[model samples]
Every structure is written in structure tokens, then in C-alpha cells.
Target: MVVIAVFKSSRPEGKSAMKWFGAAQQRGTVMALTALQVVICTVWLTTASPTPYKNSQYITSKIVYECAIGSVAGFSMLLGYIGLLAAVSFLLAFLARNLPDNFNEAKF
Candidate 1:
């Protein structure tokens, strides 16, 4: 009888721990994705122009072209970051829904 009671009590605790662990993992993933997005954006913006040039006389023209390309790349990276954030939010919601009732009984 004592063993049965102990098992029943521990089950709820275990479920609670699992829920918290899932939440933490999801949050960490989101942070990592955000960091990666920033790094990608920085790299795209700082990379030199890929176009071959004849001489240094066209340095100004090259700068303008590279700036335009960088702008487009930055915008694309921004969109990707937003999409990743939305995906992470959806995953968190799904995890919350699937968590046991005992875990949801109290507000975190």
C-alpha cells in the first residue's frame, strides 16, 4: 500500500518535470535560431561583391551594386527569422496542449 501511494505521488511530479523540461528546450531552440539568423545576416551584409571588375576606377559603382545586393539579402534574412519564430511558437503551443493535466493544474 505504501509503495502504491509513493508511485502515484511521484507520477505527477514526473509529469511536471517533463513539462518544464520541454518548455526550456523549446525556448533554447528559439534563442539558437535567432542567433543563427543574426550571424547569417551579418555575413551576408559584410561579404565583398562577387562581380569581377576591370579596374579600381569603378570602385564607387561597385559599392552601389554591393549595397543593393546586401539590402536584398538582409530583407530575405529578416523574413526567414520571422518564419522561424512563428514555427517555434507553434511548436510550444503543441507541447503545452499535449502536457498532462496535472502539469497544467497550477500556473507557472
Candidate 2:
């Protein structure tokens, strides 16, 4: 909404640059997150195993196994990714903390 509103109005000094910067930032963040998620999911799914069930029974043998999460490496990867995201978010927040609430894009 902010970007749309800014673009809809008459041109103003720095408005074009700020809006473009914000849009680029948003796109980059989304693409990075999406790529990370894809890599994580691919890694996790590739490492997954079929669900285990008790028995030597015929019924158990008939059960079809599906992908299930169970791997130390996958968990570690997820944790590392989460930590990285947290660290980045924290850094951005800290940097923006001093900015005023209104028109705070300057710091960003």
C-alpha cells in the first residue's frame, strides 16, 4: 500500500528512488527466503525415510511408506538457517531502531 500510494501521487524528491529501493529490497528478501526454503525442503525430503511401524505381520507389510522427517543433518541445517535469519533480522532491527516512525525508509 505504501509503495502503491507513493507511486500513484505526483512525483516528489527522492520518492522514486526510495520506492524503487523498497521494492528491490522486498523482492530480494522474498527470493532469498524462497530459495532457502526450497533448498531446505529438498535436502530434508531427500534425506527422509519411510515411517516405521511395528511388526512382521502381513498387514504391516501392506502398508505403504511415505516420506517422513528423521535426520540429524536435516535438523542441523534447519537450525543453522533459522539462526542465520534471526541474526539478520536482529541486525536490521538494531540498525533501524534509531529511525523515526514516520518515513523511516531512510535508515533501511
Candidate 3:
């Protein structure tokens, strides 16, 4: 009876751990993709305009446009990252709740 109880508890713990692992993997993928996107955007911006600004008004307008686009893209990426972090935190909490009582007692 004691063995059966322990086994039952471990099953839920294992499932919870798997869920957290999946969440972490998902976050990692998103992070990688976001980084790739930023890199691509940077490359595209650099390659798009090869000519130097000739007039003060043109330079100011160009700077404002580039800054606006960069800010928007950066904000969107940051929001996605924050969302991923929140999901990971929630998953971790769920996993902690289902973890075995002795989980912290074991050494790595």
C-alpha cells in the first residue's frame, strides 16, 4: 500500500515535470526565433539604404522613420518575450505544486 501511494504521487510529479520541460523548450524556440528576426531586420535595414543623406530635412525624416520602425519592432519582440516568461513562470508553479515532498532533499 505504501509503495502504491508513492508510485501514484510520482506519476503526477513526472507529468508535471514534463509539462515544465515542454514549456521551457517552447520558450527557447521563441527566443531563438525572435533573435533571428531581429538579426534579419537589422540586415534588411542596413542593406536597404546605401546612399548617404544629402539634406538636413531628408536626414531628419530618415532618422525619425528608422527610429519609429525600430521602436515598434523592439516593443513587439519585448512583449512576446514577457508573455513567454509569464507562461514559463506559471508552468513552473504548476510543476512545483505537483512535485514530490522530497524533491528538494535530493542532491544533483
Q: Name the top lDDT candidate.
A: 2
Q: Which lDDT tens digits does candidate 3 get at residues 3-87? A: 2334445665644444434556768877986787677556646645233434546565554322334345555655676677779
The residue ranges of model 2 lying beyond 4 angstroms of the native Cα positions read: 1-22, 49-69, 101-108
Kindly report which residue stretches of model 1 are placed more than 4 angstroms away from their true locations once superposed.
Answer: 1-31, 47-70, 105-108
The residue-by-residue lDDT of candidate 1 on 1-108, one tens digit each, is 222233344675544444434556768866987698878767765773234434545674554323234356666777787887789667756655644565555776
Better of 1 and 2 by TM-score: 2
- The C-alpha lDDT values of all candidates are 0.58, 0.65, 0.55
RMSD of each: 10.9, 9.4, 9.4
- Span of 10 residues, lowest total lDDT, candidate 2: 1-10
Q: Write the per-residue lDDT of candidate 2 for residues 1-108, one digit (tens) a residue.
A: 334335444456544655544677878877989798788968876777335644445565566544444776887788788888889778766665554467555664
**Candidates 1 and 3: which is better by lDDT?**
1
Model 2: what TM-score?
Answer: 0.51
Clashes of each: 0, 0, 0
Worst 10 residues of 3 by lDDT: 62-71
TM-score to true structure, per model: 0.41, 0.51, 0.34
Please estimate how well model 1 matches the true structure, expressed as its whole-model Cα lDDT. 0.58
**How does residue 105 of candidate 3 score in lDDT?**
73
